[model samples]
Target chain A: MSAWGMIKTIIFGGSTLAFFFILWFYNPFKHVEHYEVEKDVKAIIDNPWKKTESGKTIAEEGRELFVANCSSCHSLRYDGIYIMSVQTNPKWKNIEKTAGRPVYRYGKLYKDRFFVPKDVYEAFAHDDLQSLKASFGQVPPDLSTIYLARGEGYLYEFILNPQKVLPGTSMPQIFNPQFDPQAKEKVAKIVAYMKSVNTPPPQEQFKRTVMGVVVIGYFLLMGLLLWKYRQNLLKRLGYH
Target chain B: MGLISKFIDWIDERAHIREIYRTQMVEYKVPKNLTFPYVFGVLALVTFAIQIISGIVLLLYYKPSIADAFDSATYSIMGEIPFGWLFRHIHATGANFFMAIVYLHMFTGIYYNAYKKPRELVWIVGWLIYFVLILTALSGYLLPWGQLSYWGFIVTTEIPGSLAEAPIFKDFFKAVAETIVLWMKGGYVVTDVTLGRVFGSHVLIYPLILLALVGTHLYLVRAAGISNPDGIEYDKKKNPDKFVPFHPYITLKEGAYVMWYLAIFFFFVFFHISHFLPPDNFEPANPLKTPPHIAPEWYLLGYYEVFRSIPDKFWGFVAFNALLLLLLLLPFLDWSPLKSARRRPLFFILFLIFMFSSMALTILGTMPPTPQNAMLGLIFAALVFGFFLSLPIISIFEYGWYKMKTKGGQKE
Candidate 1:
């Protein structure tokens, strides 16, 4: 086969896709930036009075505080909830961190999910307080699973510098990076809330190791059934 | 005043390209029954486009000198340049995905009997592309000058060096490979020499070759058209001149499929980027240190696993390599009267085994590549050989016996 064929295919296919990208990415009319915020933040917005820690440990206290202070825009799940993307705001760099993600954990869900509060927040800014008190157009994300999306270091630093990390946003910088704000007062408390929201890794995932054998067993049964089914089909078709 | 006419003239001159794109492309109608296996070809194409475009942008900022090689790459991504990070991530991420899709596509070709005679060159060219991709990945990895990139270079290139005919040749080969290693240090050895070469290859040589090869692969694919599951060529013999131009038929079909694949690719690009690639690659390459585990690209994990599981070095190397080389002989080994797997009974089972073995080996390779992994590696390697290379022969033999028994021992 001619190697050029692959090249042409890519060139042709990619150029078409690039056209789509031009539409998807370069939407000037789209001024309202959307982002996927943290889950606990969303939970607080959905129902601030919803039970906190009603379960155990520091997580319970963290949830209560999170629902009370946060939850306006943040989501309770790992998927993205539209907040704000920096590309929308021409003056995003000029604003404070309040336009992006908030610092300090309002609840347990915000602790572990690293990228939302940092990576996502750092990438965009909020446009107005109407969006802010309402949690930007995007729901704040649940921090419980943030670390898995971003990383520990990124999350930790985000908690340290919410404003500097992401310039514009409604998320207030509760922790001071210069003096290293109260361990339990600012970042630590938020982290505790995030930790409280953490759930154990899925039990079914651990069973994947045996998934190979499980698949083989499934195939074995299916193969046998298939042979029988084929035989039946053959009979119906008057082949044999 | 004459832009439209000028465009018409341009099209007239490159009429073949226009015809190829507009009409000839749709001539060979690809089977609409293709499932997930069909997406790999499209995925491979996407990867090449990403590599080429990102590679071009990166080339603008990447420095080939020893002092700034790694930093230039770092800047291209995270620095002041516009969309540098996106380009870098896309290119970097594209490498991993390309290799994976290539392997998947190659396997799909084999399992579906798409590499029978006439399309032998297609498979061979694909294999060549595989080699190019490996080189591309090797050079691209070092662009970062990180610990993984550094050691990754040493471990990978060492394989070819070991096959050198003479000691002097071997030493020279190693030295030549290590020249960039020296320059990467900002010295000789691996410090700076390696990083410089890596960045140069990543930005300059590999991307150009990749572009050329992609064109060739596509041309042949379009010229030959997608191989039917029946392993029949799209020619007078099988098609019997009942051909339709590619303009609307296949183009529409491929276009529809392309959009579906794009939806999936975009989902991963935005939402699942981290899971597909490691974060450490984002940092600049460093030569002195090593990551917790030294592993090959996910595609090579199968052989790496086999290599680790075997006790003897010679046998390990042979077993590890045979896992891939095994496919080149499939055209002959496949003795099924019908080319389609639907009729070919036993060969299909063996194909699945070959696939599973490779996948299993990749997981094993992620672990430490050490002597203690002998049993696991040996078993998997044996399976790889049995499943990939020997399965067709085994199927031929088994079917021959069944045929004989059913025919009451008639020699004819």
Candidate 2:
């Protein structure tokens, strides 16, 4: 057999073997943490700062780190989430929603749209920001009710125990920065920022036209790259 | 007679299949003295299989729509179905296990100069498989549409999101990041739409990529054979028949290693009870709901630290990408003509520091990215980076340092 053919067969066989093994040996969904808003950060990491604003303490320091590392992902909305001692059987469906469905999310505040404040250029795709807008439609959900909406401390716990929180999280480790000593301090400060950010964002007076020029430029480049990649794919697939 | 003739013709076309199967079953050859580290690659493959089978079974009971996605995914595991939780934990834990083995295999290969000479393609193919595994792991994490998965995805994408200001990347940055994420989400803003797409990609697209890579890698290894201890030579005259059949000879050795993998998988599966993130994920992926700390998966610590370490954007990109890129370049690094780790003591020590530094950075990256934290992260990251950059230079310097010390003759 040709070398490529042999490789193809091996891969195919290996793939089949893998498929059977997972079926026999383990659960695929077990790693997926079901969604509930009770943050378990305390359990994941030892957070000296529970809910205090004390300065220079682990709590305050964690807030700084939270802002640096997390603010971008986490909204500073105090009201949107609800924090309580985690109940193992706390009604997962007890979550408040619009018409028995989970309330849809909007982009962050301080921008014209929910997604506008997001770094659109750095998102997974240009349409990603747009689809973000399209998905939620007009009024993005506000953070004013998140703590009440989800719960407090859940966010903290999620951050703290990411692996225990969710497997394959892109978030790297923080508590055991075995090489980097400053990791704990950074997390503390970031958490502090989240705590401090309570007020809802004021209405935007800025142009709704563009956040940065990334939107337009991103389209042109992606179009070209996609086209080139398609051409390459066609060649590889012998489609001409 | 015509029908019989047709059947015979069909059988003839696929005659090679029968032979190929027999060839591996009966006469496949492998090197003797292959070490435990080599088994990791196959072990990862085994775990990959386990994940796929269990994943498909879970899909039978899963509803990928945002409305019931979390619940369905949740029920599929939480022991609602017979042995359902087993499937879920196996796949999830298996992902982590797969990563561990891949890292082990890669690192061992490097330490033994496994990428040198005939095994170069093996190394390259192996790394490609690792890349596919990352993509698979990323997609699988998203399928549950849980709180951690949602926030975790955001954290994972955050750095890439901030790269929008690349000065040159422009809209392509926005378009690429936004669209793909949109695709991952099936819509945007981490909705059911996103969950569905991520599910399909996790189960199908990514797995296909992984399988392809694994196939190519295994073939490459067979074709090139395994790299041995650094000092070993391949002279046909010196040792004509130093190899053994892979089936009975090597498989028996691999048997013990496989047992260890199974034990680890079950240990986490049962005792850990699928240690998923906190319960906030039952709600749909909510953007407004931000988890206070946003750390990436553990494997990416070094790059994460590099991102935190550097306050700047472009440099952060360079440093972050460089950490992994350097691994790909191990073939070119350390040109002291001494191939083995044992031969060059200083190289070995510095490289150990580099590995530890990477591990440290990965852990550090998981924390919040505050300035104080970042500044310290940077210092520590710099120390680690120093570890990587100083290897060859230090390896060179040590040669002189050793000579100078010896010439001084201060020893008793």
Candidate 3:
């Protein structure tokens, strides 16, 4: 073979071999690293908070708890400038102090004591943002989305024993010591709340009926087109 | 056939539909030498239809308010509506595949120099379609209001700010930049108004404009006729046999390709759900937070790399936009009488270099602006623009060389 031809062979053949070798050895899909959780956690579970009337109550309770405990640092809504401030502001320590929680001002007669904002009170009981940020050391992510990103089992375990699931994390073991008596119920409520807030998007299901009809319809159309094509070719060939 | 013909005649007499059909479909002729590359235009049309149908269905369930947009997409369309997932996936995945096919179609045009002579307007309109599609995709990106879509628009909106420091008319340019930013976001920042406007543009305005552009494009195509693969001019007197009606022959050929394309498209839509639509997008948009790294959709990675490679934001933005505009001007830049790369060895090799550099730039675009990637990106960006800048010079030189050789009777 010519030198150039040999070079082309080496390039194409070697690359093909290399690609397959990489695929075999380092298959990304096969080696996907799932989020690891505690031994008891299933790591992968379907929505644990089943949609029921009781489940809705538990979720509502969890929403109250989340606002009191989590919302001071985190958020549920995706809009507003506070979110942007959290992202762009580097002086978080300073902002945490001066940028006090948005509160409703009753009047000067109230001695400027912060009234829980009407919106916050309307949504749920308000928490002191200044205190929460000091404890957490940084702004916590919007927990409203944790259910979407994580399995329910993981959330349940993480909330039950945050230190157990994730070491050196700031999430206090709210259940291990106090909520332990009703830990399962509390965990369920929180999970239900997270699930309620972050509802699993209605997913695309395989439309078997549509697929069946489409496939059959397509084949029927294609067969007719092909038959006409063959007849046209035959006519062109003088096969009247 | 008889009943259909009778029905068609009945409508034709009242609506004059038969003449339109006869001119556009039955008598529309394509080159006999057409290959798989030629089918990309038809595939683009098919995917555009898919996008429109799927998008309309999605719009039925989609609420465009900021507070509700994300939930409407995730809960209502994805979770609540029956087969909503399929429509959403088809629309989302169809956009990606449509852009892919459009690129392939554009590349085929560029490779064969289909923009030459009488076909320049067709190429220009097609390029405009492509430009509008980019806007359509980006505007639709904001509708989902997910973290990725939100942050992606944030990163994109920053493009105007890059123009703030333009050396000439720095104040005026800054004002122009601010106006563009305002126009896009509709306020100081991205909010409900932004979502409302973007949603309107994506669903209503862009599609109508795209439809109009597509109509003009098809009119031009019908007028000019499809070019041959060899880049030779059509000679009616000598090459009557080279013409074929587009109905059965081309339609059947394109139909097979459409099936293959749809098979692959549906394969991703069904089997590989997250491959086209990233899971990062599932997280609701947080105005307070940006993702660790922001990137455009995968299709825009090549230009995105060029955008990020330069340290200077203004020049980087200019270079990135120039990359696409240069492609639009390829026909004019290519001064050679010879259209096809088949006979132009040097030009063919250079085209290969340009293609590889583009791929390299795309890879680089996806990576963080690490020092090594930045260096490679700068080099590849140079190679990409260098090819466009030098094409006319090389074409003139090549043409002169060929003339000299032929005049000297070097060829048998």
Off by over 4 Å in 2: A1-240, B1-29, B76-79, B167-188, B274-284, B334-337, B366-376, B387-412
TM-scores for the candidates: 0.57, 0.57, 0.76
DockQ of 3: 0.09
Positional deviation of residue A58's Cα in model 2 after best superposition, in angstroms: 39
lDDT of 2 by residue, B1-412 (tens): 9999788779967786657755884377655556556777778778878777877887787777754555455533432355555567566677777776677677667666677666667777777777777777777777677666777776665555555656686888767666655554455455556666677787788888888888888788777766655436555345647555565555644654565556556666654532333334444465666765555566665677787678777578767777667666666554444455545567667656665555555545655566876777787677766765775686577557656766899421
Chain A TM-score of each candidate structure, as shown: 0.32, 0.28, 0.45
Q: Write the per-residue lDDT of candidate 3 for residues B127-194, one digit (tens) a residue.
A: 99999999999998888888999999988887878899797889998998999887776888787778
CA lDDT scores, all candidates in order: 0.54, 0.55, 0.70
Error of 2 at B94 (Å): 0.9
Candidate 2 chain B weakest lDDT stretch, 10 residues: B273-282
What tens digits encode model 1's per-residue C-alpha lDDT throughout A1-240? 358547635643564355334323442322322434355444432232234455444444555444444444443322222233332355543333333332222122333222233223434433333455365544353343453334433454565666755678556655564666342233434445453333222232244324434544554555455556655654664433
lDDT of 3: 0.70
Q: Which interface RMSD values do the candidates have, in the order shown? A: 18.4, 21.3, 11.3
**What does candidate 2's lDDT look like per residue over A1-240, in tens digits?**
579547644753464345334433443522433344224433323334344455455444554554445433333222122211111114412322211222122123222111111121123223332444464342223232243224334544544566766576555455554665754444434443343332111221122123113333444445455556655654664433
Interface RMSD for candidate number 2? 21.3
